[model samples]
Target: MTYILQLVTAGLAVGSVYALIAIGIVLIYKCSGVVNFAQGAFVMMGAYLTFAASRLGLPPVLAVTLALVLMAGIGVLAERVVLRPMLKAPVVAVMMVTLGMLIMIRASCLAVWGPDPLAFPRIFPDGALELFGVFITYNYLTAGVLSILLSLGFLGFYRFTAVGLMQRCAADNPRAALAIGIHTSNQVSLAWAMSAGLAGVGGTLLATLNGLSLGLADIGLIAFPVIVLGGLTSLGGALVAGLLLGLLQSFTDGLLSPMIEDLLRAHTRIYSVGALQQVVPYALLVAVLLLRPQGIFGRKGSERL
Candidate 1:
């Protein structure tokens, strides 16, 4: 039971990071109707930025903040430079452009930061807290708490704020919103900026948890299963799905893998089943799509789209 609790805690921490990145993907999809494949690249870039800032003598908090700000600017620039021209293009074209953007960003990061993985500075105090006989690290606790807080704050913003309402309006119907005097283009730009900024924070959190590396961007791929399971248009769905996937992955890694391995050893010739946890989310994603295409919190009408 204690081991289970420990695994759960660890899963929640990693899942929270996925949820953050997933939220960014959902935000861009909701507002612009274009899937931003460059999200992983943004994560990679943000980690590099944080690493750069740390090298320049800034503390972790300041470095993360600076990285977020710069990422937001980069988001805006990406929208202006890469997306704006393709705004009138087909959805497939826009998506491909984003794929191109991802490649460009990855190459740029490699050129500037090089191909070596660097150790990220510790953001939280180095220690673990014991609760009910389970040891939980401050890094995990901080990341999980902060991710939840930020997600809730974003939810509140979407629920009550004027800017968020404008964003929603733009997302719901860009032409109608423009006809009604809202600046649709500006709203789209804001969405990209916010989405990129959130992705940056997620990246920083991940780097702090795991060491900094180009591979951190692969979290974006993990996020796809989260968003698909949660529904692409639903923020709340993203949160719940992220946490669920995280916990599930953790549990599988900690418990199920060993159990399955032992069972296989006793009964079959198979020696190992490697990284079963990584496969879980994708499997869940496929099941969700086939059985409940609308997702847990997704609106019924959205299934048509």
Candidate 2:
């Protein structure tokens, strides 16, 4: 029971981070009608920026803040310089450009930081909290709590804030919004900025847990399964799905992996099943897409001919 509790704790912590990142993707999609695949790159870039800031002798909090600001700027720049120009292009073309951005960010990070993982500065003090025999480190606890708080906060902002109302208007009908004097293009830019900022913070928190590395970008890929499971248009769904996926991955790593390895060793020549947890999200993604194209919380779209 204690062992199970520990796995659950770890899973929730990591899952919260996934939720945070997924929310950003949903935000961009909602406002702009564009799927930003480069979100993961934003996550990676944020962490690297934080690392760079810390190396320049800034405190941890300041480093994270600076990185977030930089990330938001990058997001706006990408929208203005890349996406805005392609407004008349095909959807597939825009998607390809986002993918290109991801590759570019990854390559840039590799050139500037090298491929080796760097030690992330301690954001939280060193310690562990034991509750019912489950040891949770301060770092993990802080990250988990912050991620959940930010997720909830962003949801509230989207539903209750003035800017959020404008954003919704723009997303629901650009022509109507424009007729009413709302700048739909600026709303799209704001969406990208906010999304990138969230991704940055998520990345920084993840770095606190997993250390800084280019592979952090790959972790961003997990957000897709999360958003899909939650429903791409549903922020609340993203939060729930993120937590669920996190728990699923954690269990696969701690319990299922060992159990499978033992079973395989006794029955076959294979010594291991590599990174089963990583495979689980994509597999789940496929299942979700096949079983429920509209997602758990997403409504089916309708069009008038």
Give per-residue CA lDDT, model 1, range 1-305, as digits (tens): 99988998899888888888888899999988888889999988898898899899999889999999999999999998889888789988897898888888889888897788888887889999999999999999999989888888887898799999999999999889999999999999999998899899999888889888888878888888888888889988898899999999998988899999999999999978999998998898888888888877776657412
Return the TM-score for candidate 1, rounded to 2 decimals.
0.96
Worst 10 residues of 2 by lDDT: 296-305
Counting clashing residue pairs in each candidate, in order, gives 0, 0
Residue 7, candidate 2: Cα error in Å is 1.1
lDDT of 1 at 263: 98
Q: Give per-model CA RMSD.
A: 1.5, 2.2
lDDT of each: 0.88, 0.92
Per-candidate TM-score against the hidden true structure: 0.96, 0.96
**Candidate No. with top lDDT:** 2
